[model samples]
Target chain A: MRVIFNEEMRAVADDLDTMAQDVRRAINLSCTALLKSDVEAAQSVIDGDSAIDNLESSILDQCVKLLAKQNPVATDLRVVVSTMRLASTFERMGDLARHLAEAARRTYPQSAITPDAMPLFTQMGDFLTVMADRMVSMLADRDAKTAEQIILSDDQLDALHHKTFDLVLADDWTGSRQDLINVVLLARFMERLGDHAVSAARRVVYIVSGFDPTKEPSRDEGTDID
Target chain B: MRVIFNEEMRAVADDLDTMAQDVRRAINLSCTALLKSDVEAAQSVIDGDSAIDNLESSILDQCVKLLAKQNPVATDLRVVVSTMRLASTFERMGDLARHLAEAARRTYPQSAITPDAMPLFTQMGDFLTVMADRMVSMLADRDAKTAEQIILSDDQLDALHHKTFDLVLADDWTGSRQDLINVVLLARFMERLGDHAVSAARRVVYIVSGFDPTKEPSRDEGTDID
Candidate 1:
């Protein structure tokens, strides 16, 4: 009986890891759709959201079932609960990416952000995809060290985000002010995507260390940027 | 021992409810400060965020402790899990309100929105406060019916948002495009606030019913208004 129960629990964990991988793929696909203006790919990302949603619900249900039937304790309970929360955040990240793709689809004909602005936005997208991929790896491996590296990646993202903002504002007085504004807003949205991925990575670290890494540095404690 | 455990459980539940109430008040204070451009009030809201943050952490800790200690089953476990999840959403609402207030503070001496746009903007503010107030009440009372009402409030907000957008676009947006963009973006932020509040209410209903209330047909679902 014990061996069968253990096998079932292991299978459930493996399934959850696969769901996380699906989310990573969805994030990548959405980013591609955004950069390439592939409405079909963007539509697929939108369509695939229901699958991600269903996966989230299933993971939560399985975690609950495992806790109930197997009576997981200590590290096991933490791992299950952390995975549930991570799944929720990951699912939302997918939704946000799809939303961004939809925005790209709508703005395809008109140059909302001129081709000049594309490089920074593309960099932001790459950063987000890389961070998201690392998060998936950390979660699957319980890799505290890799999770720590992912946490550091957020600092680099912040610098690039500041540069993007400055570039947007520098060209704000140009003819297409509306386009400039849209570009800035879109850039901010991409930066937020990276932030959410970092948040997922933070959860992986917390799952192992039992402490929130981001809370370590007070967001405004020593910042005089304003 | 059973009696002692029951007493402890009741105490935790009461504390969790109080924390929710604190979150409610923090959101209201932040919203008022943002709409009124009241710097002092904004400062107060900023100060109040710590209390909300502390409340959320404590509530989550207690929930985890209970889960570990009691190994609750079925409804009892659900209640504890739901409380933690609801608190997470509530804390996010508080953060969003704080962001709005900060925007108000940053743009002071020259109001965030133009004078002509004030009426619609204030309408948005009023609707948002009502939505927040109703959400808090529903959470306190576990009133699913009232929670559903808050979801409908978003439609009215959307109408006002569209009106604001049209007004902005119809004007000869020539000079000070940056200012105009800020105003429009402020409106967008307010719209997002309404969305998040409705999301929180939906989560409340989910906690009570164990299903998503967002899937239910609201009157505004297919209203072709774009």
Candidate 2:
């Protein structure tokens, strides 16, 4: 029974890893779609989201079945349960990627990004791509240090996101309202993509440290617009 | 053993009920703070979110303990697990309320919603309050039909949110870029709060109907700028 349970847990991990890979691909495609005005790529990302959602549900079922059949306790339960929590974060990450794609699709032949903001957005996309890679690594390592570093990368993403605002809000800004709106919303979508990474990373931290930040920390993490 | 497990499930339900109530209060206060520029009220909502987060973690602990000890299966397993999913959605709802309050606190002395947009935001808040109330009821009744109505309310919230974009994006929109940013972001936060309610409500529907929308639905739920 112990051996079988271990194998089942491994299967769940593999599922999450696969989901992460899908999200990684989706973000890359979404960003390309955004930058290149590639409608097909954007549409692909949007359509692929449902498959990711299905995987998330299947992962949940695996967790429930393991609990029912194996009756795992203590540490094992923590492992299974934390993974379940991470599954939703993973799904949200996919949703963020899909949104990125939708932005591309909505703008159609024209890129969603304004020329002045393109450099910043490209940076944001690159940062997210790296962060997604790090997420898969962190999941494998479950090393709290790796997870913490991901948070630091998130800070960088936030910095880039903040930089966009000054441009959009400046008196010298000459973009149309629609352009400004696109910039505002896209910057936020990128920031939130980072935030979701942090949440997923934090869950890894929670599992590794065995201290639930939600309970243990009084740290005032101010709410982002994300 | 059966009776004991049932009682344990009841305790978990009661914890969630308390959470829903706390979240309801937070949303109302947050909205008040946003409209009235009530810094103190906004601050209260911000500070109060940790308690809500703590409750969420405790509820998870309770769910884990029951699963580990009772090894619940079949319909029993479904009930416990679905409620656990709803717990995160509940926690997110609280966080959204806190974010709403933070919007007020961040912009204190200056309202987040412009005078022209105040009526719309006020209505959004009222709708969310009603939805939260419905959530608590739906949780008690586990009524799929009530859950569906909650989604209908969310559709209305989406319409109100969509209505804001036109006003903000119109050629005549004269607000500063900063105000526009705030209005755009706030509208999203409110819309997402409604979406979270739908997720929670849908989880109830999933448990009752045995139909997992996460798995079955091909509906293109577009990505939020959130």
Candidate 3:
């Protein structure tokens, strides 16, 4: 029974890895769509979000089944519960990517990002892609250090988000009201994507160190312009 | 042993009820702050958010302890897992309230809602307060019908969110760029608050009916502007 439990746990971990990979692809594709106004890439991200959501549901069902059958306790139980949370976090990350894709699709033939803010958004996209990759590595290795690094990286994303806001609100910004609205929402979506990645990394740290990092105040709180 | 498990489960339920009540109050207070530009009310909401976070942590700890100690299975196990999700959802609802409060605080002595958008924001605030109350009732009763109603109500909130965007982006909009940003974020925050409520309601439905409503496409998805 113990052997079976361990194998099922491994299967669950494998599924989480797969979910993270899908999210990474979605983020990259969505960034491409947003930066280049590629409607096809945007459509692909939108169409692919359901697969990420399905993975989350499947991971959750597996965790519940494991609890029912194997009855894991202590650290084993924490792993299962943490996996459930990671699935949800990754699912949200996928949705953020899709939001970006939808933004791109909405402005097809004209990029949502203005010329002045393009560099800032490109930096944000690069940060998100790297962060997504690190999340996958952290989950696989279960290294608390990697998880902590991911948390720190989110601060940089927040800075970039604020910079985007400043750029849009500047006197020189020539975009229309619609353009300003789109830029603000897009920046927020990217910021939130980083926040969700930080959340997933924190769960991994908790699972490995048996310490609840969430007990600390969340950095993402009260940071939004609103 | 069974009696002890039952008693512990009851304690968990009671804690959830308390959390819901706290969220309800926070929503009302934050709305008062937003609508009236009451700095004190905003501060109260911001100050009280930590308590809500603490409650969520305590509830999560209790759920984890129950899982480890009692090794609940089948329906009992589902209850524990579902409770964890509910705690997280309620915590997010609290954060949304705090976000609204923060928005109010940032614009103290100057209201975040423009004169023209006052009625819309007031209606949004009322809808949120009502939804929070319904969540409390649905949790206590485990009534799937109330949960479904909450889900439907979120659609109305979504419509209001879009309307706010239209108002901000209209050619006649005279607010400064900063005003536009503030109004859009505030509206999105309120819309997201409703979305979180729907999520909590869906979890209740899942716990009661053993049917996963989340399997269906989430209505909140793809609705946001960019």
Candidate 4:
């Protein structure tokens, strides 16, 4: 029985890894679509989101089964339940990526970010892609150092978000209202992507260290990002 | 054992109910602060948010303890785990309220919404207060009818959101870029508050009927509010 429970735990971890890979793909693809105004790539990212949804559901189903059958306790109980919580954040991360894709799709034939603002977004995509990759690695290894690095990188995303905000509200901003709105929303989406990664990492810290990190870092409240 | 487990489940439900009430209070206070530009009230709302966060953490801790000790199964297991999910949404709802207060406080000495656009926010707050009331009731009663009503009311909030968006981007919209940004974020916070309420209702629906509603309602995907 114990051996079967261990195997099922392993299976849950595998599902989460798959989910993370799909989200990483979505993030990179959606950001590229936004930057390039590629309608087809945007559509592909939008269409692929349902697959992430299905994976989250399957992972959650597995968690329920593990709890009901294996009756895992102590650290094992934390592992099973945190798997559910992690899947929730991963699922939300997918939705955030889709929001970025939708921005691209909605602006089809027109780039969402004006050329003057292009570099900021490119920087965001670059940093976020790195953050997404680290998030997945942390999931597998529970490396506290990796988790700290992810949080630090999120600060960079926030700085970019603020820069874009300042530009849009600047007197020199000659872009149309739609352009301003688009960039602000896009910036917000990127910042939130980082927040979700941090939230996932904080949950990992909780599971590994048995110390609740939820109260320590207000930024770690991914749910509050909405 | 079954009886004790049943008592613990009731307690979880009760904690969720308390959390919902706190969120409802936060919403009303924050909206009042925003409308009145009452920085003191806004500060109170911000200070009170930690209470909701603590409640969420405590509820989640209870869930983990129940899972480890009682070893719930089938519907019983679903009840415990879903309570954790419910707490998450409720905590987020409280955070959304805090965002509203932050909007009010950030713009102190000047209202976030212009007088010309103030009526719309008034209507949103009035309607949302009603919806929040119904959501709390549904959490306790698991009333399907109440859940449907909550979804319907959320549509009203969405319409207001779009109307405000159009006004902001209208060719004649003469408000400062700061006003436009403020209203947009405030509008989003209000819409997301409704979404969180609907999400909580859906989770309740899931708990009561075992019907997965995640796919049925796209709005409940809180990340999709963009």
Model 3 chain A: ten consecutive residues of lowest lDDT? A217-226
CA deviation > 4 Å runs, candidate 3: A219-222, B219-222
Query: Per-residue alpha-carbon lDDT of model 3 for A2-30, expressed as tens digits?
Result: 99999999999999999999999999999
Instruction: Report the lDDT tens digits of candidate 2 across residue range B138-219.
Output: 8877888889999766778888899899888777778888888888888888888888888887788888988776775743
lDDT, each prediction: 0.67, 0.83, 0.87, 0.83
Residue B114 in model 3: lDDT? 87
Candidate order by TM-score, decreasing, is: 3, 4, 2, 1
* Separate DockQ for every predicted complex: 0.30, 0.58, 0.60, 0.55
Give one digit per residue, the lDDT tens place, for model 1 in A16-93: 677678777777776777777777777777777677777777777777776666666677667767777777777676
For all the candidates, what are their Cα RMSDs to the real structure?
A: 3.7, 2.0, 1.4, 1.9
Residues A1-226 of candidate 2: C-alpha lDDT, one tens digit per residue: 9999999999998998888888888888988899889999999998898888888888988998998899998878888888888888888878878888888998898888888989999898889888888888898877788788887677788888888998898888899878888898888877877887887887888888776755647322332664
Please state the Cα-based DockQ of model 4 relative to the true two-chain complex: 0.55
Please list the residue runs of candidate 2 whose C-alpha ends up more than 4 Å from where it truly belongs after superposition: A216-223, B218-225
* Better-scoring candidate (lDDT), 1 or 3: 3
Q: Which candidate number has the best TM-score? A: 3
- Residue pairs of candidate 2 with colliding backbone atoms: none
Off by over 4 Å in 4: A217-225, B215-225
